[model samples]
Target: MNIIETSQLTKYYGKNRGIINVNLKITEGEVFGFIGPNGAGKSTTIRTLLNFIHPTSGIAKIFGMDCTKESESIKKEIGYLPAEINYYDDMTVSDLLEYSSKFYEGDFDARTKELCNIFEVEKNKKIEELSSGNKKKTALVQALLHRPKLLILDEPTNGLDPLMQQKFFEVLKNENKNGTTIFFSSHILSEVQKMCSKVAIIREGKILKIETIDNLRASNYKKVTVEFDSAEMADEYKAEGMTSKKTRGSQAYFLYRGPVEKLVASLYRVKIKNLNIQEPELEEIFMHYYAKEEE
Candidate 1:
């Protein structure tokens, strides 16, 4: 069963469009990445999914549970970490977690202690005393202690140190292996590429594309750059959909589908030193969507 599904899920704020016709589906036990540039409505879509705000039109379902009607029940089985977390500064870490546990009916003491130990969080310290990263970790502990079936994270690694971030990813990986569905939102392509199997690219409050990472790469999309032996051979190559072409001595660079036969054939006569194939960065691919979307 699809763990989450949305069809034309749209939302608006006053006259400002938040998201429009956002069609997204996340399969069970899969990590889906929500990618978009800043102010592109990533958070709005998430809020609509969580029913924190009602949609302007369209539908959303979490594990077949209606987003509008069953949000209370839906939240019980979902762990969510928003981009920003605020806490009562006077409360100790232990008190803060204990207080938040009242929302969900669960025995989180064991899990809470374990998480604190693993994350190296100080239980006795007041919330005001912790570093920004530590405070963020406290929020994470609350979100995960419920042991929900689905996890929704927005920019989860923002306040985390590199070491803690890696450790946290390991925890998420373990959760995924245990059959949890994860929907992670972030603009960091490298981490999304590493952690998510499927992804949706959104821009200007609209979803531009959704596909498996493998399928995206298999679209015969590549960047080909060739280096030539003779300085004069650089002029022989041509490119298609070629955004840029540069020549330096015998070395030439072009951005297009690889195995540039026409360009290579022209350079074959003089000196062909080496050829390099560079994969398009996710941001570049995302920009392609943006350009198409704008048009």
Candidate 2:
């Protein structure tokens, strides 16, 4: 079953635009990444799907129920973590999660305790007393405690430490392995590249690209830099149909989009003293996309 379906799903803020003509479908059990920079309308799209705000036009459906028409029902199966969170400051972490559990209609004690242990959150601390990372961890536990079918995580790793972030991803991966559909929004490109099987790159409220991880890997472009014995040997680093060269010190470097072996052979021809290979990160690829779009 399609876990989420949106067609021309548009949202506006008075005269301001949010997302326009967004058509997307998410399949069951897919760990999908919604990749974009800050203020590219990623949050706006998430809010519309959660029915926290109404769309100016178009439609959004989750589990076959229209977001605007049946948000109450659809929310029952959704586990959402907002990019920003605010709660009763006076409440203890234990009290806060316990209070939230009331809305999900289940005894979340076991899950809550287990999550607290895993996330290293102190249940005795007041919500206001906790650090940002701790508060974020609390929200994650609350979102998962209900065992919802779909996990809609918006900037879910916002306040985690490096160790905690790894732990959270591990937990999410396990969830996906067990049939939970994950639609995560993130500015962390490396995280998305590592975790998501499928990714959609959105910018200026438009989804510019969507592809499987394997496809993106295949499309990976490497920047091959070789330090030759002398600048006189720099020409040997050049390959057919390859352009864009930069020289610093004794190194002749150029970008490579073909097999790694070709670049290695070209370097060997130059009697390279040393070599460096840098792969284009998703952030680099995304910047290339937007930069070209503007042109």
By TM-score, who's the top model here?
2
**What is residue 88's positional error in candidate 2, in angstroms?**
2.1
Judged by whole-model lDDT over C-alpha atoms, candidate 2 comes out at 0.85
User: RMSD of candidate 2 to the true fold?
Assistant: 2.7
Off by over 4 Å in 2: 223-229, 233-236, 239-243, 259-276, 279-283, 290-295
- In candidate 2, what are the lDDT values of residues 1-295, reduced to their tens digit? 8889889998889888799888778999998999888888899999999988999888999998899999999998889998887879989998988888899877778988898899888999999888888889989998898899999999998988899999999999898888999998998777887789998888888888888978877766777777788876775456863557888767777767778887677656557677788876656788777776789
Q: For model 2, what is the alpha-carbon lDDT of residue 164?
A: 92
lDDT of 2 at 48: 94
lDDT of 1 by residue, 1-295 (tens): 9899999988989899899999998999999999888898999988988998999999999989999999999998999998988889889999989987888996888998888887888989999888889988988888888888999999999999999999899989988999999999998776787799998989889888887877765553556677776766677655545557788887777676544575456556556678886767756777776677679
Name every residue pair that clashes in candidate 2.
none
What's model 2's TM-score?
Answer: 0.88
Model 1 has an lDDT value of 0.85
Against the hidden reference, what TM-scores do the models get? 0.82, 0.88
